[model samples]
Target: MSDYSIRLYVDSDYEVTRNLFRNGIIEHHNKAFHHALQRPHIWLPALVVLTLPALNLVSVTTSILVVLTAVAAIWFYCRYMYTSYVDYALSDDMLDISKYYLQRDGFCFWVAETRGGEVVGTIAALPSSDPGGEKHLELKRLSVATKHRGKGIAKVLCRTLIDFARRRGCEAVVLSTSLAQINATKMYEKLGFRQTHSFYPPGLLGQFLDFKIIAYRYDIPAL
Candidate 1:
């Protein structure tokens, strides 16, 4: 977009980028909450609570309270899930972008900035962690500010990573997205990425709640 430009991240961009990362990930909690509500394990009990009023097994007031409680629980669970991820990320590579990405060969982080120099988006690429996988780059932390979206910022950021991977002799680029990020998943598909696999997030809570994360790979074509 004419209003924005892409450039490598710097120490001065830390606060804005950190806030962007935190807010972007946490914003999906509502979507996850609604998604969870649609699951049988989550909603069935709420459904039973709703039917209690009609079946005369519980007063209407009591049934409403039960349903409300279930909804609140689902919301809290979704909130916890997203916040936990944000916490882990903030403490990981994000905790020191320069040391983890800038200083490493075949690894870098970039930000999309407004003409006025505000950091509105971020993306990073690093060598894949899988043992013996030198030909793959892992894309991470792709986020564009809400108001600045829909102007091709995300697509350009992704293209930047792909180009970087190509230059690094990487055969493909890989990334992971949560099920809550439906729009992102669709965009990746449209960009020619294929679903490599899907898995629930780590931890007993993630497994018990059945939250899913999808992995995608984009093979670089020969120049």
Candidate 2:
């Protein structure tokens, strides 16, 4: 917040912004891994493995092998999911920022630059899925570097997008965040965003997992 100013994204800022987003997701992933490991669901698999040996349904050696396999599978699954998300983002809007963001109507990307010319944060606003109804705007890729946290950079970035959307006659601003981002959720709430939808991937795997993505919407007042 000292000498930093938020400005529209440019071609030269693409690499820096992309890397910042990648690192931000990785930071959340690591925190989520630790939080998930502490949950009862992770322990349930081990509990079943231990109980099988005690109940004589499986031999001790077999029980140990099963536990090892389950642990390995869980580890692999988490890493795979994280990698998939990163790859998709890289190939999507982040791949060609100008095409997906800059060139689109009612879409814009912004990056926060320091007095020394370092990009420290980014945020964007894009047309909502239902553009004809309610005139919505979706805020995307809001992130600030770790070293720049607690300095009001994120708040500035968020406000910048919201104000921009308001000026364009948007009725509301919408965004989504995963459960892993506890702090971000709180910040959104503090910014007057209300929880609108809770989402999770489909299928049996999703039912068994604790993963959830929560959507929030901020109703904009007429300017």
User: Top TM-score: which candidate number?
Assistant: 1
What C-alpha RMSD separates each model from the true structure? 1.5, 2.2
* 54-169: candidate 1 lDDT, tens digit per residue: 98889999999888887888789889999988999999999999999999899999999999988999999999997666899999999999999889999999999999999988
lDDT of 1 at 182: 89
What is the lDDT for 44 in model 1?
81
- lDDT of candidates 1 onward, in order: 0.91, 0.84
lDDT by residue (1-223, candidate 2, tens digit) is 8789999999999889999988887667655555556678787778888789788899999988887887667666655556678789999989999889989889999999999999999998898885464589998999899998888899889999999898989899999887888889989998899999897766554334556779899999875
- Model 1 stretches astray by more than 4 angstroms: none
lDDT of 1: 0.91
Deviation from native of the Cα of residue 203 in model 1, angstroms:
3.7
Q: Lowest-scoring 10 consecutive residues by lDDT in candidate 2?
A: 202-211
lDDT of 2 at 53: 77
**In terms of TM-score, how similar is model 2 to the real structure?**
0.89
Error of 1 at 26 (Å): 0.4
> Candidate 2, clashing residue pairs?
none
